[model samples]
Target chain A: MSDIVEIHMPKLGESVAEGTISEWLKAVGDSVDFDESLFVVETDKIATEFPSPEAGVLLEILVPAGETVPIGATLARIGPAGAATGASPAAAKPADAAAAKAAAMAAEVAEPATAAAPATASAAPAAHKGGELLSPLVRRLAAEHHLDLAQIAGSGANGRIMREDVEAAIRKQLQPAVSKVAIPPVAPVSASSSPASPPAAKGDKVVPLSRIRLVTAQRMVESKRIAPHVWTSVEVDYENIAKVRARHKDRFKAETGASLTYLPFVMRAVADALHAFPAVNSSVDIEAKTLIMHSEVHLAVAVDLDEKGLMAPVIRNADMFNVRGLAKAVQAVSAAAKKGTLTPDQLQGSTFTLTSPGPLGSFASAPIINQPNVAIMATDGVARKPTVVGDAIAIHHLGVLGLCYDHRAFDGVTTARFLDHVRTSLQERDWEAEIG
Target chain B: MPTNKEQVAEEVTYLDAISQALAAEMERDESVFLMGEDVGQFGGAFKISKGFMERFGARRVVDTPIAENGFTGMAAGAAICGLRPVVEFQFADFISQAFDPIINVMARHHYRTGVPVPVTLRCPFGGRLRAGPTHSQSIESYFAHVPGLKIVAPATVEDAAGLLISSIRDNNPVLFLESKYLYRRLKVPAPLSLEPTPLGVAKVAREGTDVTLVSYSVGVQQGLEAAEVLAREGISVEVIDCRTLVPLDIDTIVKSVKKTSRAVVLHEAARRLGYGAEIASEIGEACFWFLDAPVTRIAALNTPIPTSPPLEDAVLPQTEEVIETLRKVARS
Candidate 1:
């Protein structure tokens, strides 16, 4: 309690790296209570006041508002009321620091701060010391490696084991075992790596990318780099679904508060077509030269987040939902996506991805397949065009459905037939009943 | 598949993105309109809608008297009548004047009668400009407590447009907190995407294997800066931009914490019961077993912002603080 308690910048958010001090409620030498508001920190995403974690006199203020600092940087310091400020070299001595650390560790264990203590204590055998402390990560790693904590030398403060320490111990134990067994010769690392790009040209403007843009760019590049893509498209008459949509859109909106778009119809058709042509709905295991045909139709719908980037929120079990149900599900998921309310689970485990370029009036498109999904389908714009019907010229809704697939997973004919099945389903299905 | 509808983007300031989003929504939907003090003729205090009055005409961008409560209540009424009204408060601090209408009238309209009240309140918040107490305040926490009120604070140019569009389209009361400090500071390639950025979902500004730093609004910029500095020191820090306040994205925070085993919540609002507290508590509860260090929070001092630049500087949470804090937490 007599030692100075330093206040460091708390990690604000998972992605936030720094913060700006906006204001300070207390001036230097102010008698501050524990958990009292101290100062405001404004980051790229928020501005908030920080409370004092410990009670003491505000001995120092290291940062001012408008100045930005990285996460974990010390903002200020608190000390005992009678302790001298501006100079506390005695506290920094190795012996004193060790004592302070020991006290802190003891406090962490004695208090309810370490929530895992009860569980750890309950699981411990009689041989285990009551005072021995291990971080959850170290504890888990110890269990996984089947290593006794007592045997491993800890490098952390006060002999506390760390992840790196455990990893080193594991490596040391594996070396002798590996030397005794027959081991294959390891390949040399690549010698010719691409050189760094030349410095920016004179008078050239440099632009920094947002996180979403960076991720999208990386994923797109990786997808294209890894997979050899083959695209196939089919022209289909959408008159049946268009008629059904025209009849039920108004009533559908009234009942469900969602717009009845052609996407859900396309989704249903694709789901059925995928079942008919399982090869088109699969993942390619390049090394094994095997195709994993996913039983569940987890459709990943690529939602445009404007120029920020794109996110593919998955709707699991797409085959189970009918046109109406799919329409509701798509609407809910898309709305959640647009509103930034999507959970992490909604973004994973997609067997197929459906991207619609129809609303943007695209006639035909071949979108990149989302990773782990063998193929991606795109719905193009539908228009009323004159076509031969029973040898007579008639106006009908027409559109193109395109599929971009992993060439390694299936041949061109598989995608071609898959598109044909989808086209046939859209052109001839009982859409009215499906819409209902 | 070929996404032939790829859009060409132009660079713009954060303020211009907001203006573009407002105009785009107004043009896209007939039910959407604007109401605020001097929003029409004056084009807003910061000139966010400088030419909007001329472009959209007075009918869509209506000017109002200096009565926040009156205009707020009128906007709520208009929303109930099947119109999406975007009400702009000159300063977020002034929102307190219309708190009754926002909390009592607009917040619970749908729950009480099932008829949606689609009203978007655009509040210019945050400090660092030395505008003094009344003009600069982070008021999201106030409305965040009220149920049914969605609060979104976009830190990037793209999100400023996308989230605003989603806020206007949302069929409920939404407080769109536009940071005044970021109005002209942050810039991005524009032709800004009008796609709606989903609310309540957190964006990972930077992915890292070390500690997780959570923040929103202006705090995000600080977090990014801190991460860059820490990266040079071989400290991999993950920064999460919490775009929305109400319906806080605890899942994203929890997930990140589970991976890194350490978390630090940063913000520019008062520390006492600030939004960061909620995040810290959530991480504590959700990732207790995964935590390597206690969840830490860095935020503003609980005091009204001052006019003097130096005094204001003393009160705020600076980037250095965040850096030191992150270093300590990461190592510990």
Candidate 2:
């Protein structure tokens, strides 16, 4: 028997050329038993503890922990003391291992240093069998698009797929889908269509868009891309609500310490309408092909941030609150949004949304729906207009409410009915009594 | 008539810039002195110290015999005694003769003791003048492995002045590897801001988005030339000049490689175990996910340089080879 048995790194799996010595279980000169765990080796595929081939006193450690080396590199040496003669007392399969060792020793004597050659040769085809020869960037890009690597042709050296090759394949795949539709090339530009900004003039001030604005832009584009939208509008008579506000405005402000606004009245009507028409207050799980009709109306109110950007903070359980209670909650959330102090929780879980373009004197504006909500309504300007009432020309306060909905959630009839319900509640509900 | 700033910006060669930096440091500090063979009355082997003996006097600029080990050891002792001694080697190839003093004595002394050794050895290195194997050699890879020594190889005329001053002022042993090929071939506006180019910071010589060429010393000039020719064929290339080999600024290299997704490391040293291997390995580990192709290396053949011009040209990295590598990487 040899005096010293050199411990070499074992072949770790297919395509594993090297591994890191993550840890050593025993220090130098420590006694070892055959088939006992020795050290931990971590390769790209797995981390495993290797066992001692020969039981002896550990003589020397060539490769220290935290160092990586190629396969077949010497790791340590086991001296003759306490060495096993032919088998071990605790070996799991002594006969099989002894025969294998004899064969390996014979092979080693025939071709020294050729142990790793066959392993490397066997690993090459197994590596090429999976992904063929695509670079890391190309592999990630292909995985992102759910592309089959075997189908795409590579143009790099040795047919290795490069980044440009993957990108070219993606462009080629998109051509047929685009040209199949005879639609005009004048379609609205997509978010990814124009990655670069238009050239600026010599005197132009090029300030990068704020982070909030960028996020808002990306979400808006994503919402449009996923949802097919349809818009519906309805005119509401606010004459009765205006008269009630005239009677109770000063008292309501003095009692609540908050100014009475038409937003609360509109929010009250919206909540009631959402309860009446549940489909309009529901979200659609497109992947699952199901509608989620939330029981409570968590209303997301759009707040403008001093012309910089927009934020939508939710008013939890808006349906449970009356006009005055809704007024306080809306004011608190709007103030928080303006002050940049809204928590992430306050901005999520909205089942319905409302955008007030009326303050800016806009009419019949179509606001994008805040996802994953199914609908968003815009309350436009309110003004006194001459209208015919029972065959007589009369002056009335009126406003136009526009509702944009995901067509997949509900059809045009549902959107129209939901808006009309809000209009009826706003025009005929006892607003004076409710405020008092 | 030239304005004050214009007169201050008079052009100078790379060799003149080196001479000016040494003179400036010696004048600024009384403790600073120059010691090398023929550095005094003979005015240096390359005429770098032509007027140093007359201006600073013989005491400040002392010439020594052709004994590298003796003078190098003397410089180490002088540095420990609080004097800034700048030693010059005629050719970087001859540094091996003094390897014992440089590696064993000067390099480990400061680490063992808290005392600082401020010795700067000026080595005129690189091959292009048919200086044969003994005279034309790059020794950066040899010294880069040492722990206590800082290595800086300046490519441009401006850096030849600024980096040397920084090395002289540094409170550690620094090997200032000056390129003998670019000593006269490169020129820059004189009156260089003699401000120290901080060690371990890389400079982007040219910016492009297609592929990055990481190099230093003479390789930087070759990369720039290759980038110029590749631009005509619509292949963009970014060139990074690693001014210092020790305390390498891998951040800049990684950033460029991340943007370009491909890289090529170039050097004039032998391909086997050269300084470029370290840079290439660092790039592989840092920018693994961003690589579109393997990190290629274009360097001298793994053989000693021959005396013949044609043979030397074949051994050393050339602009055409760099251009070809760039084209391959850019397309990949």
Candidate 3:
């Protein structure tokens, strides 16, 4: 007899159900050695290569690369040890061999059972034959309940049975009937134990808060309790800025290969204003009783990631980058944050922040200050409307800026001046000169 | 003080039961408080919180500004600071204004930070009284779409009181949608204890094998009434109250559908993108092979609820619609 070797895919992990074959190092008809790299599989979390278990000629490859097979499934077959011609009988056409093995087992069982019975009893009627030992009704009921014939152990003549056997089997498995009993209802708990006291009796349900919203709630509360927030709103005439944006947008995109947005313009204005009023760029130290002025401005731009939530990704050193560079950074950071692929470093280090509810046409929003930052600015929805331009009312691009600052750190006057600076910078933008 | 006999046997509306849950939770747990427009001295627009202010005082039972966004945000803050805030939206329709706080920040807080927001937003939704488009609205589907936010709609007074307590003690943001129509209608024997009803569990209000009527809020009552009416006609319909929409009790739904092989989802919200659609889809996916008929949804028409009584009646789903849908599902 030849030893039959069963080849199977190695179990990768406890939870891994399947793995994709990334590469196959061995080819058919190639001589292989033990522990040789056979193929690599890639799972969602990690990738690893499987090694050959035994030394032999590569007889067959059951699975191919880029295919995912279940654990214990045949992956490849290797010739058994000490086999002639380097090919074991076990490696021969698996399908035919399996069929031959099944046929032999069936014959072996039949040979013994038939020899013990009378060879010729004139072939008992088909209904009373060994194969038909189970009555039609019994067979039908057994099939309906998915019961095995052998498990039932028939008790009729020559171990044959009728409908009574099937019914008995079912009755044995089913519950015995019993008379119903009535029980009095219990009294409810006193009103004191009830959460909805006084009016609510019992059988009330209570649900809890979600994690993300809970954190947001906590942060907002802490910010409000710790930071003395004072709001300053101002309208900005963006007539010149809008004109410059429209004129240079195509050129800017073509030159830099980055989409130009109103955010870049607003960011540049805010950066310049921060330089002009350094106090707005500073934060109040609640513990040290002093204001900490940062040398660099790490601007945190809050992006609406979804309908319900906002995420702020910082663009380090906003003062150092021009409008085009700011746009690129914002686009990259915002994209990364939205996909939840941002690294730890990407979300950290911010001295100031900006939030916008654009296109939705929110006129103004009082952004909660990112703690330790004395101020945060918000850009409102921009729309074209009639505005006083010099001596005449004309349709010019206009928008409102809502500035919220910690009153303890920066006074309303300082906040107002910062807004004016941003307004002046946007309204008086000489795009050609600024870009150069 | 003499014990008033009326106090012992007095009947209260389901809305009052909800308020009582809030009041009791607030008194028992120091962290519990009430926050929303008119929830204080005004005692809630629906008067659910009526007399709460005199009992709990202004500090705990506080009224808020018209700023839905602002007050909701503040309530989120209070919840995070260890206070359990039960926010009452004057009308479920007004909840859209605070959608940001409910969906974005509060729903995400627990998943992002591992800290729970024990905040419950109470919305009096649904319509039968000609409240028109503004006052009567069912936006439960909007919040149910969001993860990490538990959506609970109690059809019976027992659930109304029990769900409120569960929401307070729960460690996540919960959208408690109270049906305004059922607030004074459905009544049940008071539960034996104040224990919370488990979330994600469905109750088979009435059982039969001909057809399954799946619903929550006022729809559950409608389903029950429909089932009763159908029973007299020899079509046995099972009514299931899906108290929670998010962590849907899919097992119960699947088992019921497997036994009955037919199902109808009933809700007061518009048919398009409504919670009923979600239920129908889930049922089809889970019990497809077992289903004898395609899941049918009986919901309000896809239109803004009109002011006229005739228009409103035409737009909103009724017991007849549920019964018809059940019959069709059963036959198919």
Candidate 4:
């Protein structure tokens, strides 16, 4: 049997379903001892190292680096030192995947020891709908969210809407993609959609949705419902900025300890264009049915936390900032995000948005409009592309800029103009003037 | 059930209702008299017996010194002689001083000697006035356990009058509890003929199919309020006022509970062995299988009433608590 042994992923926590393999510490065939960190895995909550249960040689690594597989799936295998090729555990067949996923999900949903026994829902409900009332807090939430109380089935006494039911409904309202129509006939429409709620899954492994994921899910649903988002994209040539940045890259970093990136240059152009088209730097008060335009542009920059989630911390009042200042603000915000010390106020009061999916290697994206705010712009990756320069073909630093604006505030033409303005600003910024 | 058709009358305050019941009973029987610390000249502590002296004369409305134990013994002696005596304690807390006369003499007179002690002890009770622990007490729960005495607490003006008259006319000694908070606050139609509502008969103050809410005195008022709030959200709450505690109207409670499959009992007394607990136990025994949820009890915290307005308010059971308990019970 080659004495082959497999090191499956361990149960992480009560709420963690899957963990990303951040790095494999021991490569295949590396000799290891018990308690040695074999690999590092990162859940949304924390990054933990898995230790070798027994002293052995590291064998085949099943899951690769950066892949987020269900927890308890085989990460790597180990055996007696210098075990030959046939000693490795065979790859999981088709049947193994489903079973592994279910086990991983079960661990995430393990109730705390202190959790009281749950109330059974399937017990034949006593006949008749009585006037079982909702509490003040639950009522307030239903009113605030405009949820139909009749539509929500309460887990409360006599089918009353306890605070928990309302909270579950509020969470479900955020993900319109999973609304009644979208929830396949597997479960009832009025059933709880909370990640914490137990779903009657025959083969499905449901895990609790992380807090960040819940918030993003809600915002995405709200933005789609409130704003008629119209997107327009324009390709830009960044050859001049590339040359200017290449010339002063080392000096800029040495002096300011900040890498001069195209984001700051793009942010500078966005601020300038926001000033020209002031209507774009405004929010829609849907309730009051009013449009509020801002004199100063508080630019929200969408920073992806290595795909854990997205956080758009505002670079408050970016219009007055030059290229260097914008770069510093971007760098400061990104650093605060990495250290997880960003203040609450830093996240709010965004009048316009600039998202750099460029760093994440996206060539083009139609990002959703950050609601209340009239517009959001996605900075696509800059790559070398051939362009005709006065009838001669030449390689240039090329990028695409996409703008998604609220059509409630303006038409497609105006949004296109705003997008064109951003494209022109990026292509024509006098980079040498600022570089010197 | 004898058919005596009763007519609606004008509205009266809870205090006036008590006053009218005393005057009407005294005039009808000629032997019924009232005695308390300030009941005659000063018109009682809450003026519940106000103007009784002017109409009934000093002989009938006899004012006594601040001696609950002494005067209560005298009243028990008078009841033994065929005089229906209604004795008032300024606040219910002082009833503890008269516990000997209540349990030993008046409560056991009919059983011990076959002579009916038709004495009604009027106790004005309940917290939430910033009244300290001694003054604001719901003490019926203590005597509710006594075998010989009938504990009757009234929440509305109508119940206060109807139950008081019934207490005065009963053969056994009765503890008539009137919530001080609801004394002059709640008003109901005055009885044109002083028709007494039969004792131990529970009144469904508000009806709903979802759950049955059993409460007495001030707790009934809170249940009504909780019902109104819940009704706005479409939760139908059935509130029952168990006017008489000792001879509880279990039939009314059981019927409502059996229909709803959920029940909750509420009172202003401390929760540990409170009257509500007695009702809960009875429900568990009688309607065990019919219940969809465990019977719940809502009562004041098991602590003395605080003098601080906020603290005292916190100690007493609230409509919010009733709403919360009923929500859980109905769902269960």
Candidate 5:
């Protein structure tokens, strides 16, 4: 084994490609043990302190504070306390070979030839591949240190730079001005280049969407594009449903430990209606030009995520679940979505979707169809208003039901019939029969 | 205060100013368009975009069905696809039909995905024109509860044009609630250029010192009228027009309240749980120490807006109510 050992920055996380050096714990010529704190680096998400991997005297500090470097770049040199300045024959040979292999890999990766050539040519043939050209090791180092090869000057054999050469360049550039360091003024890249434009200017702050939000946006856009949607709204007399809910509130809560919401009852009614009118519960296979109807109901309930808006998590085999089960499922999925703990499986595979604006006071709303699904049911706020029933004016608990369907898959008559079924099921209080 | 140009130009309505803003923006940016019921040939329920159909044509000045939800959703989709769509609700009260698209979808678009919904909803709101309950409402508070939605209620004709233009260009979903009562009643000279009035900002409509009167929409005019009356009585009142409600321009409210140490919020909406509650709460939270007296809110009585003019006048907050609230707060 060679006596000289190379010190490189380590990869910290899966997505983090580079980190900015926040501070250096030690200086050049400092003796450090393996696993000793060396420097602190900051990434967009988090900051962490890196430790030395090899126990030896730090021959050179190759990077400086406030400079960003990539993963696996040579951060420093660690060797025996009194080792010779020149690389050992054995060490130098493999380093040269590694560099040569990296150069070949770089050529395959299609890295900018002009930018990487000098570093690849100067590094020893073995070290050329192993160092900066483009090896797994160099890539990892570049990611950790956030080092851009285009900026560094390579000093390896034939001007082919290795990892060490890149690190040396970074260290030289970052060093404090000892004798009026000739620093070039950073030119304004562009008006848009500023991470965030100043507040005085008409600028905006953009935050990237989390995984759930991204999925929601994509699904919504897809739904709108794929589905030619037409909406029909009808105000239903929720008098019976509200009365039933009020009467059995305590009993339902005691039995299930879950408050009976209009949502679960609505979901149950929708499921029963779906059973009768399967076409409304079907999805179109755009590629196959076929309508796929499912016997089992996988109902997606739209859950409000407060500031993050809405996400739909499906309740699988919803037809089999009772009102209590539906409520539990809705609550669970909603909790998972709000907390952002929902797995991919939890979000996928729904035959139909339901959305409600709750008490935020929308009388009626046409919900966009969840793509691939044939229809979506949107329930509006329940308000006590006067309604005419059989030529008699009565103060009924009125709630508007908005049904938006893909006209390509289902016709207005079919959707209206399905909505009628939903209305009848809710008014009848036949929960057990519907569940059965 | 009539300038030569203002005296020469036909006295344009507030709705006309808004139409001018839309026409100007559409001409300036190819990405800007208008979508609402009867916006194209029918011109709009209030005729705000009357000549827009001829000027911009069908593609840009779109006539949508009475499906508030559908059109609002379509506008949101268009906005996401890099188009600036100004959607008009025939009556602000009818906006309830499009709540999901506005609050759930458009308002949350940016915060959820960093994708902007540069969509503007121009609603002819408020009561007193005998439009009755279904047509008359001031539901701006309903949208103000939403996080990413910017609510602008422009009082003056300048703000009517500027805020509508600003709302059109904003990178967030904006609710531009124009008082139906002010549609034809207010007037101003045509703007030199189509410049946007900043959103989430307030302006001191009338300067005073004894008490600060904060209001928006038609209530702003009432507040200004009340301020003039109070000024004669030696009560210096500062009247503030809260142009945008959601981004409440709390700094300006706080600053004015700090100076006056007394405030009276006037609105034509229902007194209980109206947007006045929000303003009063904000003032209490931010300027509690600076306040000499509790923030008083003078709003319409909690009742369905009546159709009879006298009944409507009785229920709605008038200039007298604003004056009364100012006097009360000032004395306290």
Candidate 6:
């Protein structure tokens, strides 16, 4: 029989009973193929795309994106293509409360990281006789028992005659003679099932962690546990650098085909500061309790990754870079990283690092220190804010530089002094002359 | 206590182990003797009593005529006189000829005449080798229904030897079923325990949490194979070998059922009024609330044995049947 299947919001995590629709890959009227992604849903732990269990036309969109619904709540309906719509409202009713309850309970007990299938096929009773697909074993058994395949009611996938179907038939034929002792059939356990039921997790897809992500995770966890992290932030007046960028940005972009940003200027100042205070570019031998100061200031620049994370690739001998040189190096390294063209040699031997949330408009961010590097700084949003200059209020370009340092190599006062120098160097730069 | 299977040495096949136990027991007690057809020089039908003719005298390992009734009668009388007689039936299906002596005489000797007849009837049963019709019949259900007769069907070499020692030592009459398939099919280390492993005890052949699988004799081997297949596919199966058939270790079966919340029983005998029905009924009554699914049974069709290989396979219960039944119960 032709029946409409309801696609429900999947419970992506063990404790999560609801998920907000992030986006619908297919519109309500689109015809979906079996196992094709219908929509993307975001749970507390991850964002997952659910596929259509059966190939059919999407008839309705019940819960729009940005709306959170309880697990097992119908988000869409898929029916046979070209079938008349709104013909069977009664068929869409919640017929199996026990099954729906069981699905919800199963989702509640599901593990948080497991990709359990969120949407499920309807629990409507299957009509087993007419078009059941009999397996070879089932067919052999039926022939042996002289049973007409048309007489058996199958409960397998798509109303197929699984071994259970034949066995159930055989059991029915043998029941009266075999069971003279009045044996009670096992009570149908229609109660809420455990979270491990495979059908309940069909909507949950488990994408294995990529190689980069896996290595990044392991290194991040090791760095967090090994280092004693101390964070300090300083408000920087960026009026001068902002003026420099505005004056020369068009000419710079025309010459280099790349945007001129404040990070390149910040990097130039950090390299000089590292040269002044060599301890800030040193690595601590935690086992020997000695600081191994680096001679070359190999500065690592953070590149924004695909939404979830990032990678910091080092620029070799970065201390020698002037403002223009640093800006060009940043453009090339970041572009190479984004294009997946970064070589292994280019990403190694960094003595200091910089990460910026400036473009994304973050007020402040404590960037994690890359291992073997004593300090890392984050450049916060550059916005025009009112500040006191010469005892009068003036609207000047303003920002904050957050420095996260390893306290094992440098104390609070030394880290503060480095930040003060970086602020002074940026605020007192000759804008037009530096660009020229 | 010595543990670990690696510690045990000198492996023996299931049939040889049975012979080992019989010879060991006969050596221990002078009164314990054996009587069966061709048990002397011919070494019985399957050679289970092979070297017994040389080790023990002909008088002890006496060869009898084809007359099952006459020979079984003499054995029963010998037991009544406190001789502790052990009778060997070439095939269990032939036990129908000696049923009068079994049910009427040896089975209820203590209740009828107040005389404890310690008799052990070694019956070789089950089918797998194209030994059709009469020779391959599994008639444990027929004798299991009779009171005063304790039935033991051993699946492993250890059980074949250990359970037999316990059966011989018991004061009541015992039906010792040796799986014809497990005779030379399975090899295990010679039993270490001088003491019997105890009668009326079921063994957990393989431990799991998903579903409880119950079977006896070679069916236990089939259940284990099915358990392995299910395990690989991520379904955990608990296999319980009902070593003793009549006075079944129902407690162990119930405990596994309570833990797994699902159960399936299998037997080579026909499903119509077979012993598995009774076992399933008992499990339902004992652990009804704990069950997540119904107790299922996989057994042979109600038709008689077919001499054809493929036909016999289709009729008999095997690993496929066990796996199919278990997968359904486990899914629930």
DockQ: which candidate is best?
Answer: 2
What C-alpha RMSD does candidate 1 show over the true interface residues after superposing them? 10.6
DockQ of all candidates, in order?
A: 0.06, 0.19, 0.01, 0.03, 0.01, 0.01
Per-residue lDDT value at A233 in model 4: 88
lDDT of 6 by residue, A1-436 (tens): 1567666665566688677788889876788886799999898788988867667888767667777777666677777787544322212222211123223323222424423222221322332335354444566678777888788866654456555567789988878966853554577754443345464366787776776888788887778777889999899999988888888999998887768898988888888888888889999898998999999899899898776558898899987877778888889998999998999998888999999889989999987789988889999999999999999999999999999999989899998999988888888867567678
lDDT of 2 by residue, B1-332 (tens): 12122224567778878887888899899999999999988889998888788888999898999999999999999999999999999998989989999998889998889888999999999998999989989889989998999999999988998999999999989999999999989987655667778998999999998899999999999999999999999989999999999979999999999988999999999777799899999999998888887788877765567688866776677676688668867874
C-alpha root-mean-square deviation, candidate 5? 32.5
Tell me the spans in candidate 1 whose CA falls farther than 4 Å from its real position.
Answer: A1-133, A139-147, A150-160, A167-436, B1-10
Model 2 CA deviation exceeding 4 Å by range: A1-131, A145-160, A167-436, B1-10
| Chain B TM-score, structure 2 | 0.96
Per-residue C-alpha lDDT of model 5 across residues A1-436, encoded as one tens digit per residue: 1244554445556676666778878776677776688888788888888766556676655566776766545555556677534332211111111211221222222323221111111122223422244433334445656877666555443334444554575577567653343544477544442275445535656677787687778878888888999999777777877777777778777876676778898898899899999998898987898999988899998888786678889999999988878877887888899888999888889999999885678888988898778899998998899888899998988888889999989899998888888888777775544333
Answer with 3 or 6, whichever has the higher lDDT: 6
**All models: lDDT?**
0.79, 0.82, 0.74, 0.78, 0.75, 0.79
Q: Model 6 reaches what TM-score against the true structure?
A: 0.45
Place model 6 in a CAPRI quality band.
incorrect
Chain A structural similarity (TM-score) per candidate?
0.58, 0.57, 0.53, 0.56, 0.58, 0.54
Off by over 4 Å in 5: A1-436, B1-8, B190-193
Question: What CAPRI grade goes to candidate 4?
Answer: incorrect
Q: Regarding DockQ, does 2 or 4 come out ahead?
A: 2
lDDT, residue B141, model 5: 76
**Global CA lDDT of candidate 5, please?**
0.75
- lDDT measured at residue B9 in model 6 versus the true structure, 0 to 100: 46
TM-score of chain A of 2: 0.57
- What local lDDT score does residue B247 receive in model 4, on the 0 to 100 scale? 93
The CA lDDT at B280 in model 1 is 85
Model 5, B1-332: lDDT tens per residue? 22123323666667667877777788889999888888888878877777777777799989887799999999999999999988888998989999998888998888889898899888889998888888999988788777888889989888888888888888888888998888888876544345788887899898877789889889889988888888888888998999888788888988998777778888888766789889989998887755555577777655677787766765676676567557655642
